[model samples]
Target chain A: MIIRMAFTEFKLYLREPASVAATLGLPLLIVVSFGLLINPGTDTSSLVTYFPGMAIAFSLAILSLNLLPTILANYREKGILRRLSTTPVPPASLLLAQVAVSFAVALAMTLIVVVVGHFVIGFTVPAQLGGFLLAFVLGTLSLFTVGLVIAAIAPSGRAATGIGMLVFFLNMFAGGVFTPRETLPDFLNRIGDFLPLGATLTAMRDAWSGSFPQPLHLLVMATITVVFGLAAAGLFRWE
Target chain B: MAIIEVTNLHKRYRDHVAVHDVSLTVQRGEIFGILGPNGAGKTTTVECVEGLRAPDGGTVRVLGKDPRADRTHLRTKIGVQLQESQLPDRLRVGEALQLYSTFYPDPADWRRLLSDWGLEAKRDTPFGKLSGGQKQRLFIALALIGNPEIAVLDELTTGLDPQARRDTWQLVEEIRERGVTVLLVTHFMAEAERLCDRIAVIDAGRVVAVDTPSGLVSRVDAEQTVRFRPSAPLAEHLLTDLPEVSSVRRVGGQLVVSGTGNLLHAVTSVLARHQVVAADLRVEQADLDDAFVALTGRKLEESK
Candidate 1:
């Protein structure tokens, strides 16, 4: 039943243009544009190499902050969550299904960026495949857990989207979506390492460049996953 | 046997009391109505029975199980059509039915139920696009999709057209014939009189009377009141002394005569004998409507 519900939810997602734009179009456009257009300019890094990480991190921001929270909060505002509570299928199952869908879309979007970066522009695959996978999964859990908290607290569909956008812009800047962390001031770079999107980009990029992520970044990811996951689950109002 | 039993149920919201000591029983295979004006706590009481809300001071049992504690079990057996219910804007009628049907262990085929409710032609329509009558019929179909042993339909025909209302009543009868008990909540006296096997008339959060339609009608005080302005001044006792006149009062030049059994006939004959011409004489039967007023101490319109 949970799987069926998730599949139904996904089918509905296909009909939403804004969701498609945020989850699919934005990330793919970044990867393709950076890989083909811009020059790396000296000994720093190539656009093809640096952009896969940024594009994947950007996809995470869009899915977790924009897509997931808006959809879940809208469902609550619409009484869909309350209606599901009366059934044998627990309401948690519905939340889990939604989270699962969000994660799947984010992962698929990242994979598209990775695939396009790899074959289209002669971009190298992440050298530490296992480390890359671990970072990606943990980062998603942490980010989407925060998304759940936003969904839990937002009162209406419009309020949820507004909050989601607020968080997205704030975190995207921290994640170096517009500016590379290497060029940032020392204190700002240090701050970026602690933020969710920043931690995700740093960890994934490190894994892609042939090493495990920093222990602190991994810890940050795990702590947010556990803490925010529990908080959102506890605070969620079915109505 | 009573499939539903509510005992001394009391529910309050903040300082305002919604259900004040409401107790009613619904027998199996009967159309039971909780008839009352708007905000009379009909919805509150039934919501408790549906396990959607908990009573503040009493217990409600559905199918011999406590509604609150046994909600998971009760949900499968009871269908509820709440007053302000709505579906997701884009959900198609067929898709909504399929999703709900998946919740039950043995759901009726939604295809057949859709046709039964005259909604087969609207299977592909989105809920937000359906007309008021179509939306209502779709909701009825959804409620019966699980083939519940009992269905709670609150204010089911509030926004429906007349033809739709009559059609829905027929559908309720058909559902009853299939042996599913129904709990109907409404304010329409005629609907209650025609459809309910028994009704509990609620007022000010209390069940004022519980009886069959005719039994309630019989409970009405059979005094018919005649109000008119007399053409000439006459002694008030001339109208009050008659055997049929229960009482006579004069207010602002209009004579009010109230009595049981032919008060109008008796009062008019006296006016003629005395040569007291009456102006603007109006006579009306004080039937079940008056009974509601008598019990509640307020006209139904005023109460609403």
Candidate 2:
């Protein structure tokens, strides 16, 4: 039943062209557009790590910060969750289905970016495969949990979208998506290291450059995941 | 047998009471109505029965189980169509039905429900694109998809046109024909009169009366009025002398006679004896609307 619910949710997600464009099309567009300009072969600088990191970060950010909150809050606002509670199946199944769908989308986008970047853009796969996978999993969980918190508190769909956009931009700036962390000031980089998106990008970059991620970055992501996951579960309202 | 029994149910919010001292019972295989104007606690009462809200006081039992305590088990037996609830805009009709059918252990076939509710052509249509009548039909279809023994529909036709409302009423009747007990909540007098076997008239968070449509009207007053334009001038004493006639008056070439207990028969007999032709005759009796006014001291629409 949960699998069926998730499958239906995925189908509904596909029907929304705007969501598909943002989550899937936008990230691929960013990778291709930036890859053409920066030739990873000749640019031996740390700049090669910037493009793929930004693409993956953007995809995860859109899925977690924007889509997740907006859709879940909309379900509450429209009484879909209330309607589901009347059925024999619990409404939490819908919530789990939503999370599963979001996770699947994030995973699919990550793979697409990695493969397309490596083969088409002349970029290298992360040499430290274990570190890369760890960073990716922790980052996705942390960011998605933050989105769940937003969904739990937001009163309406429009408000959720607004709050999500604000958070997304803040994460983008702090995570070094707008400008490479290498170019940022030392003080700004210190702050960025603690943010979910920033920690993810820095860790992914380190793995891509044949080094394991810093333990501090991994710890920060894990802490955020636990704290925000608990908050979301505690505050969520079925109505 | 009584499938649902709500006794002395009391529920209140922080600042105000939504339902106060309400009680009613719904028998199996009958359409029981909870009729009231807006803010009359009609929805609150039904919500308690559905186990959507926990009553602050009183006991509610459905199919011999406490609604709140046995919610998971009761959910399979009670299908609900909540007021102001909606589906995702992009969810197709067929997909919505198919998805909900999986929620129950024994569900009605989605394909047959599609045809039963006249939604086969709209199976692929998204919820946002359907018309209001079609959307209501879809909601009813979803409610029955679980094959529940009791179906609760709240404000089923509040915003529908007259023709659409009538069509939906027919569909509700068909539901009863399937041996499913129905609990209908509405503020429309005609709707309750036409569909409900018995109605509990709720007012100001309390039940004012509970009886069949005709029974409620009789409770108000059995006054009947017969109006007609006489073909020839008739003597006023002719109707005044009859015991059934309470009063008689003439207004603009028409005789207005108000009385009780077979007043129409008494008046017609008198007219026939006097050889006075009564043209354009009309009879008016107390209806549910009048009963509502008498019971609550306010018209249903006025309270709205």
Candidate 3:
């Protein structure tokens, strides 16, 4: 049932140029363009290694914060969820559909970033691939769970998008996705250290730079995955 | 046996009362209409029966099981078409039907239902692209996709053209012929009178009357107007003194007698005795609209 729903949802997502462009196209554009500007740098341990993971993180933020919440809230605001509730099947299947599609897109973005970085930018693959995979899974869970909470709180699709956009930029800025490391303030850096996206990005970058992920970062993502995930499940409404 | 039963149903949102002490029973193979003005708790009542809501103070039973408690079980046997619910804009008609078909253990064929509802030509059309009437038809088709024994259709034909309304009414009759009990919520009197086997007239979140359409019309006891031009000048006391007559008025040269029960016979006998011919006579029977007015102290059309 979830597969069928995801197929239809994927169709809808494909037709949405804005969502496709932001979540999928944005990361590839960043990778290819930036990689060309810098050319083939021999410093694989520097930004080149972290950049692939960062691009994947960016895709996760787009999917979990902006795209997922906006679409789910729209379904509720438009009575689509209410309509589904009348059927024998539960409406929670829609959440599953969202998770499935978001993860698939996040994976695709990660593959593109890594492949483009390795072949075009001379970046080596992650030494601790297991740690990288674990971080990716935990990060997806925690981020998507926050997305569910946002979708639940917003009264309508348009409202969800507004809130999603605000949170997305804030998450990115605090996590240092766009800011240079030295230029960021100490207070903002400390604050981002506790956030799921920030913690997950740091853990992923650690694994990608040929080392095991930080246990503290892994613990933060795991705690967020449990807390926000449960809150979202408890607060969700079909209408 | 009654397919649906509601007892003293009450629903409130914050401090505003939406449904207050409303109750009705729908027997098997019956087309029960709930007639009321907008915001009169009609939708709230049906929602309780559909298990979409848990009544604040009442019991709702569908097929001998509580709607809220046995929601999963009731869902297979009962179908619902909500008043304001919609699908995703990009969801195609055929896809909607096909998706709903997977919900029930025993479902109707989507292709057959599409053609039955006159939606075969619109199979590929997206929901947002369909006209008002087409959307209504799709809702009905989706409601029946489960092949439910009971279908709760709330405001099924609202905002449709007269022609489309009539066509939908025919489709509803076909649904009834298949032995599906229907609980319909509507505001149109002509619709209630034409399709409803029995109607529960609701007003101000309360049920004012429950009876057959004609039975409701008879309950009002509102007057029928008899209008005609008297051929010759006559003593006004002869028409005024009749017990069956309520009021005698002169509208431009015509004498109009408004009363109930044999007013026409009394007035005509009086005219015969006085040798005054009743020219251009017309007697209007009090219809459902007048009955609605008498019961609710407001016109149905005016309520909207």
> Per-residue CA lDDT of candidate 1, range B1-304, in tens?
9999999999999999999989999999999999889999999999899887889998898999998899888888888787766776777898888888888888999889988888888898888899887887887787788889998888888888899889888888988998999999999877787899999999989999999887887788777889999999989888778899878888898999888887888888999998988899998775667778877887766777
lDDT of 1: 0.84
TM-score of chain B of each: 0.82, 0.98, 0.92
Alpha carbon deviation, residue B19, candidate 2 (Å): 0.6
Rank all candidate structures by their TM-score, best first, as comma-separated numbers: 2, 3, 1
- Among all windows of 10 consecutive residues in model 2 chain A, the one with the lowest summed lDDT is A38-47
For candidate 3, what is the lDDT? 0.86
Docking level for model 1: acceptable
TM-score of model 2 (first chain only): 0.98
Candidate 2 per-residue lDDT over residues A53-154, each given as its tens digit: 888998899999999999999999999999999998888889999999999999999899989988998888888999999999999999999999999999
Best by TM-score: 2
* Candidate that scores best on lDDT: 2
DockQ, prediction 1: 0.48
The candidate with the higher lDDT, 1 or 3, is: 3
CA RMSD per model (angstroms): 4.2, 1.1, 2.4
When 2 and 3 are scored with lDDT, the better candidate is: 2
lDDT of 2 by residue, B1-304 (tens): 9999999999999999999899999999999999999999999999999999999999999998999999999999999998989999989999999999999999999999999999999999999999888999999999999999999999999899999999999999999999999999999999999999999999989999999998999998758999999988888998999999999988888899999999999999999998988999999999999999999998999999
